[model samples]
Target: MALDKLIGLAMLAVASAVFTYYTIWVFVLPFVDESNILNSFFLPRDYAIKLPFLLLLIAGLGVGTFIGNVLIKKAEKEKLKKSKKSD
Candidate 1:
Protein backbone atom coordinates (compact mmCIF):
# COMPACT_ATOMS: atom_id res chain seq x y z
CA MET A 1 0.00 0.00 0.00
CA ALA A 2 2.85 2.33 0.80
CA LEU A 3 4.53 1.44 -2.47
CA ASP A 4 1.32 2.10 -4.31
CA LYS A 5 0.98 5.48 -2.67
CA LEU A 6 4.58 6.33 -3.49
CA ILE A 7 4.15 5.34 -7.11
CA GLY A 8 0.98 7.39 -7.34
CA LEU A 9 2.69 10.43 -5.91
CA ALA A 10 5.64 10.07 -8.23
CA MET A 11 3.40 9.76 -11.24
CA LEU A 12 1.42 12.77 -10.15
CA ALA A 13 4.58 14.81 -9.88
CA VAL A 14 5.78 13.72 -13.30
CA ALA A 15 2.41 14.45 -14.91
CA SER A 16 2.21 17.84 -13.25
CA ALA A 17 5.68 18.75 -14.41
CA VAL A 18 4.94 17.69 -17.95
CA PHE A 19 1.67 19.60 -18.02
CA THR A 20 3.33 22.71 -16.67
CA TYR A 21 6.10 22.49 -19.24
CA TYR A 22 3.63 21.95 -22.03
CA THR A 23 1.59 24.93 -20.91
CA ILE A 24 4.64 27.17 -20.81
CA TRP A 25 5.87 25.95 -24.17
CA VAL A 26 2.55 26.31 -25.91
CA PHE A 27 1.05 29.40 -24.34
CA VAL A 28 3.88 31.48 -22.92
CA LEU A 29 6.73 31.12 -25.34
CA PRO A 30 4.86 32.34 -28.39
CA PHE A 31 4.73 35.84 -27.03
CA VAL A 32 8.40 35.92 -26.18
CA ASP A 33 10.85 37.21 -28.77
CA GLU A 34 12.82 34.62 -30.70
CA SER A 35 16.05 36.07 -29.41
CA ASN A 36 15.08 35.70 -25.77
CA ILE A 37 17.12 33.25 -23.67
CA LEU A 38 14.00 31.45 -22.53
CA ASN A 39 13.05 30.71 -26.11
CA SER A 40 16.10 28.47 -26.43
CA PHE A 41 14.67 26.06 -23.85
CA PHE A 42 11.38 25.76 -25.69
CA LEU A 43 10.68 22.91 -28.04
CA PRO A 44 9.57 23.35 -31.61
CA ARG A 45 5.83 24.02 -31.83
CA ASP A 46 4.91 20.57 -33.22
CA TYR A 47 6.92 18.54 -30.74
CA ALA A 48 5.81 20.72 -27.86
CA ILE A 49 2.21 20.06 -28.80
CA LYS A 50 2.73 16.29 -28.72
CA LEU A 51 4.98 15.98 -25.66
CA PRO A 52 2.34 15.93 -22.89
CA PHE A 53 0.27 13.30 -24.67
CA LEU A 54 3.29 11.12 -25.21
CA LEU A 55 4.38 11.45 -21.58
CA LEU A 56 0.90 10.44 -20.46
CA LEU A 57 0.87 7.40 -22.70
CA ILE A 58 4.21 6.27 -21.40
CA ALA A 59 3.25 6.77 -17.76
CA GLY A 60 0.00 4.87 -18.28
CA LEU A 61 1.85 1.92 -19.78
CA GLY A 62 4.33 1.82 -16.89
CA VAL A 63 1.61 1.90 -14.23
CA GLY A 64 -0.39 -0.76 -16.03
CA THR A 65 2.60 -3.04 -16.19
CA PHE A 66 3.36 -2.58 -12.50
CA ILE A 67 -0.20 -3.38 -11.48
CA GLY A 68 -0.34 -6.39 -13.78
CA ASN A 69 2.84 -7.79 -12.29
CA VAL A 70 1.53 -7.33 -8.77
CA LEU A 71 -1.73 -9.09 -9.64
CA ILE A 72 0.13 -11.95 -11.30
CA LYS A 73 2.31 -12.48 -8.26
CA LYS A 74 -0.70 -12.49 -5.96
CA ALA A 75 -2.40 -15.11 -8.12
CA GLU A 76 0.71 -17.25 -8.14
CA LYS A 77 0.99 -17.00 -4.35
CA GLU A 78 -2.62 -18.06 -3.92
CA LYS A 79 -2.10 -20.95 -6.23
CA LEU A 80 0.93 -22.03 -4.26
CA LYS A 81 -1.07 -21.99 -1.05
CA LYS A 82 -3.79 -24.13 -2.56
CA SER A 83 -1.29 -26.69 -3.81
CA LYS A 84 0.47 -26.77 -0.44
CA LYS A 85 -2.85 -27.38 1.33
CA SER A 86 -3.47 -30.47 -0.86
CA ASP A 87 -0.03 -31.88 -0.10
Candidate 2:
Protein backbone atom coordinates (compact mmCIF):
# COMPACT_ATOMS: atom_id res chain seq x y z
CA MET A 1 0.00 0.00 0.00
CA ALA A 2 1.01 3.64 -0.37
CA LEU A 3 1.10 4.05 3.38
CA ASP A 4 3.44 1.10 3.71
CA LYS A 5 5.81 2.62 1.18
CA LEU A 6 5.82 5.93 3.00
CA ILE A 7 6.49 4.17 6.29
CA GLY A 8 9.38 2.34 4.70
CA LEU A 9 10.91 5.61 3.52
CA ALA A 10 10.57 7.04 6.98
CA MET A 11 12.37 4.08 8.44
CA LEU A 12 15.19 4.57 5.95
CA ALA A 13 15.62 8.23 6.92
CA VAL A 14 15.91 7.27 10.56
CA ALA A 15 18.40 4.52 9.83
CA SER A 16 20.68 6.70 7.72
CA ALA A 17 20.63 9.48 10.28
CA VAL A 18 21.57 7.08 13.06
CA PHE A 19 24.34 5.56 10.97
CA THR A 20 25.97 8.92 10.20
CA TYR A 21 25.65 10.13 13.74
CA TYR A 22 27.34 7.14 15.37
CA THR A 23 29.97 6.15 12.80
CA ILE A 24 32.29 9.15 13.26
CA TRP A 25 34.44 7.70 16.00
CA VAL A 26 37.66 8.64 14.27
CA PHE A 27 36.71 12.24 13.56
CA VAL A 28 36.87 13.58 17.10
CA LEU A 29 39.57 13.44 19.74
CA PRO A 30 40.99 15.25 22.74
CA PHE A 31 43.42 18.05 21.95
CA VAL A 32 47.03 18.12 23.28
CA ASP A 33 46.03 20.89 25.64
CA GLU A 34 43.31 18.68 27.07
CA SER A 35 40.63 20.67 25.34
CA ASN A 36 37.91 19.40 23.03
CA ILE A 37 38.83 19.62 19.37
CA LEU A 38 37.52 17.74 16.33
CA ASN A 39 39.75 16.07 13.81
CA SER A 40 38.91 15.21 10.21
CA PHE A 41 36.88 12.19 9.21
CA PHE A 42 37.84 8.56 9.63
CA LEU A 43 39.36 8.17 6.20
CA PRO A 44 42.55 9.80 5.00
CA ARG A 45 42.30 13.25 3.44
CA ASP A 46 43.78 12.06 0.16
CA TYR A 47 41.17 9.32 -0.20
CA ALA A 48 38.20 11.35 0.90
CA ILE A 49 37.54 12.93 -2.49
CA LYS A 50 38.11 9.81 -4.56
CA LEU A 51 34.95 9.12 -6.55
CA PRO A 52 34.85 5.37 -6.06
CA PHE A 53 35.22 5.37 -2.29
CA LEU A 54 32.85 8.29 -1.92
CA LEU A 55 30.25 6.61 -4.08
CA LEU A 56 30.73 3.37 -2.22
CA LEU A 57 30.04 5.03 1.10
CA ILE A 58 26.92 6.82 -0.17
CA ALA A 59 25.60 3.90 -2.19
CA GLY A 60 26.25 1.35 0.52
CA LEU A 61 24.32 3.28 3.13
CA GLY A 62 21.52 4.13 0.73
CA VAL A 63 21.08 0.63 -0.59
CA GLY A 64 21.40 -1.00 2.80
CA THR A 65 18.80 1.25 4.35
CA PHE A 66 16.42 0.87 1.41
CA ILE A 67 16.73 -2.90 1.36
CA GLY A 68 16.26 -3.20 5.11
CA ASN A 69 13.05 -1.15 5.13
CA VAL A 70 11.66 -2.95 2.11
CA LEU A 71 12.31 -6.33 3.64
CA ILE A 72 10.54 -5.38 6.83
CA LYS A 73 7.57 -4.10 4.90
CA LYS A 74 7.41 -7.29 2.83
CA ALA A 75 7.49 -9.44 5.96
CA GLU A 76 4.74 -7.39 7.56
CA LYS A 77 2.63 -7.71 4.45
CA GLU A 78 3.04 -11.46 4.44
CA LYS A 79 2.08 -11.66 8.08
CA LEU A 80 -1.03 -9.61 7.44
CA LYS A 81 -1.95 -11.74 4.51
CA LYS A 82 -1.56 -14.93 6.47
CA SER A 83 -3.62 -13.63 9.35
CA LYS A 84 -6.40 -12.47 7.05
CA LYS A 85 -6.47 -15.76 5.19
CA SER A 86 -6.85 -17.68 8.43
CA ASP A 87 -9.63 -15.43 9.74
Best-fitting candidate, scored by lDDT: 1
Per-model C-alpha lDDT, please? 0.90, 0.67
* 1-87 per-residue lDDT for model 2 (tens digits): 699999999999998985674345323322222332444334443443485577888999999999999999999999999999999
Q: Write the per-residue lDDT of candidate 1 for residues 47-77, one digit (tens) a residue.
A: 8748768988999999999999999999999
Candidate 1 clashes between residue pairs 3 or more apart in a chain or in different chains: none
Model 1 accuracy (lDDT, Cα): 0.90
Which portions of model 1 show Cα errors greater than 4 Å? 1-21, 33-38
Best by TM-score: 1
Q: Please give the range of 10 consecutive residues that has the lowest summed lDDT in model 1.
A: 43-52
Task: Tell me the lDDT of model 1 at 39.
Answer: 80
User: How many steric overlaps are in each model, in order?
Assistant: 0, 0
What is the Cα root-mean-square deviation between model 1 and the actual structure?
5.5
